[model samples]
Target: MSSFAKPGSEEQELKWAWIWFKQFCAFHRRAVEREREFSADEVIAFLRSKRDANVPAWKRMKVIEGLIVFRESVQHRNPADLLPLRETMRGIVSIERAKSEGYDTIDDVVGKIDPKEPDAIQEFRRALRRGGMALRTERTYVGKLKNFMADRGLTCLADFERIGAADVEAHLTDLAVDGNVAPSTQNVSFHSLLKFFTLVLKREMGKIEAIRATKKPMTPTVLGPKEIAGVFEGLSGVHLTIAKL
Candidate 1:
């Protein structure tokens, strides 16, 4: 257990710091006897993996900071590089918070995007761009792919290997049945999975057979002349102008 000599709430921070430090060291297979040293790659992998876990974003951010604190205070290592990574994580958390608050500026959305996205997903995105896919299509495919991965607890490229055709089929089925997705959305999801498996992962998944969503064709409600006149009967000002259109 890690303890701070200082009193008050700082103790809790120190405890979490110790926990993160210990977990980091253990995950890397560094024995207690060895002076624990971490590289940038290790730092990034740890953070990315944790983001996919059930851990809350706030706590994950704290864990990053805690590790930095432990390294500087306890290990006495110069963690200058780690500082930026921590700040990057902070930016992600802030962006997510802003999104939840309904701030959807292009800058905000771009800032929230992970620069170091998983290799498979990033490659798929690149492929989409290279093929001149529409911006909406790219976003849809990437979003669906992410949703599929998140559903299976996959957080990184290594985890993609565990995915197979059956997994893809099952995911599509779930989207149609449980997710209540439309046929178009289900089709997009399927194409996204196929591209990910074929182009990015370079895996040979046979033809995927999954339950598809039925397209709910929207029946447009056309108002008769009387109904339209009634709708605008008592309208005036901007409302009347809009109704006239």
Candidate 2:
């Protein structure tokens, strides 16, 4: 019997598998040409465009999900290159709309953007200082905020206005769960988000507790004598003159 006629046959399974594999390969190649890495924004934009171009929504959604997973793996290994690719993909997607069909490439995309839009990072930094965050705290918070934005495929910190309490919670949860950060570290992230929303975005965060309050077991204390001995042993080359201090 033919493969299509046998529902449980190995040949039938192989045929379906090959079909899916070919589809994935085709989408992957297209994504590669669009940019070196994929991001959530890029996936959404691509799916929207595909839908606009008459592709089925289900197919586009599946392809976008696969692309995101593949791109995230690449990002984990090489984050430095991933950011630019994400920006590039956003530009590409933006320029492909019906109103801007003639535009292509990063230069074209960036060139058309208005120069008057305020720089989000600089603005947020200014806001942070105005909100009385210490210089060191400002730097640390901005770094965390920037990384968070990048992870979520946001182009700027100003985009925090669009983010809700749930999004903030989810990000903090991921940092705790996936990042395996200490409670203190997670609390810092929580404060950073709270500040970004309340101070920079001038919005309120309602009833969200700081992640730091969730304490883990205390780290075991090292015996001081053993620590002192280890340090002293490492000073073997030094001439220790017995000086009465």
Candidate 3:
């Protein structure tokens, strides 16, 4: 058999195994007993537990590989039989590929784009439509809300509760000052979010003193008394009386 030990090197893999041994003990709530030796069954159980906890697939696989090394090199036990079942190994590889392609988690695939799937923004859109809101208005409101959630990683309805006026003010203020969006666009996002909170969610966010988008001052077009009288020159009978009135 080929040499299993690295030449001129201390058994580092065995040391790593010792580290994981303590962790595994703690995980199972077992007391640290020096005479205890881990079994393949415990390793499989640990991996199953990690899977249920949503531990990243890649990280869990590393734990398995580490245990295999620990069993073979330290305990002088053949761990080939202890390797993950073929189906489970395939599943981990699939998850890794999916993650690399940007589908890192279930939430990413389900709740990101499709807002009609019983998620936070989806529920808001449903309520808006039921209230007879225009289709375009619903899209605009939900689109901005999705952008808000995407920026902050707020993936669900529960995340909305953590939001306060200050958070909203900061987001809107960024749009006006940093994003440099037109005053009208800023106003639309601002009012849309306000309506979402008050009407759809039935949560009141009192008056917000957000940074107001700059608007050109309107100079009133006042007509002088002489200019007004000139307007009556073309009137007749009742029309003239009504104009005078």
Highest lDDT against the true fold, candidate: 1
Write one digit per residue (lDDT tens) for candidate 1, span 1-245. 98667566667776777888778777777765325677878977877778778666677788789888777777788889788887877767756654554547424333334568876577776776556455576778899889998988888888877789888889889988898889988988888888777777787877788997985978999999999889898899999998798
| Colliding pairs, model 1 | none
Model 2 residue runs over 4 Å out of place are: 1-118, 209-245
Reference-based TM-score of each model: 0.45, 0.39, 0.40
Ten-residue region with minimum lDDT total, candidate 3: 104-113
What is the Cα-based TM-score of model 2? 0.39
Q: What is the lDDT of candidate 3?
A: 0.71
Q: Which parts of model 1 are misplaced by more than 4 Å?
A: 1-115, 129-136, 225-245
- Misplaced by over 4 Å in model 3 are 1-118, 215-245
lDDT of 2 by residue, 1-245 (tens): 63355556545544443443345546445532323444445445545566678764445544543444344443333334335544554444443441243434434322333345335656666676445444567678878777678767787655666778777777787777777777778777778877777766777876654243354767997658777666566564333322111
- For candidate 1, give the lDDT of residue 145: 88
* lDDT winner, 1 or 3: 1
- lDDT for 149 (candidate 2): 81
Tell how far residue 4 is off in model 3, in angstroms.
Answer: 91
How many residue pairs collide in each prediction?
Answer: 0, 0, 0
lDDT of 3 by residue, 1-245 (tens): 76786663446656766776667888888986644677767777887888899877777766776666666666767776666553476566555644665565533432334644537877776666456465567678888888777766788888888887877787888887877777888788888888778876688866677787775546899889998889888888999999898
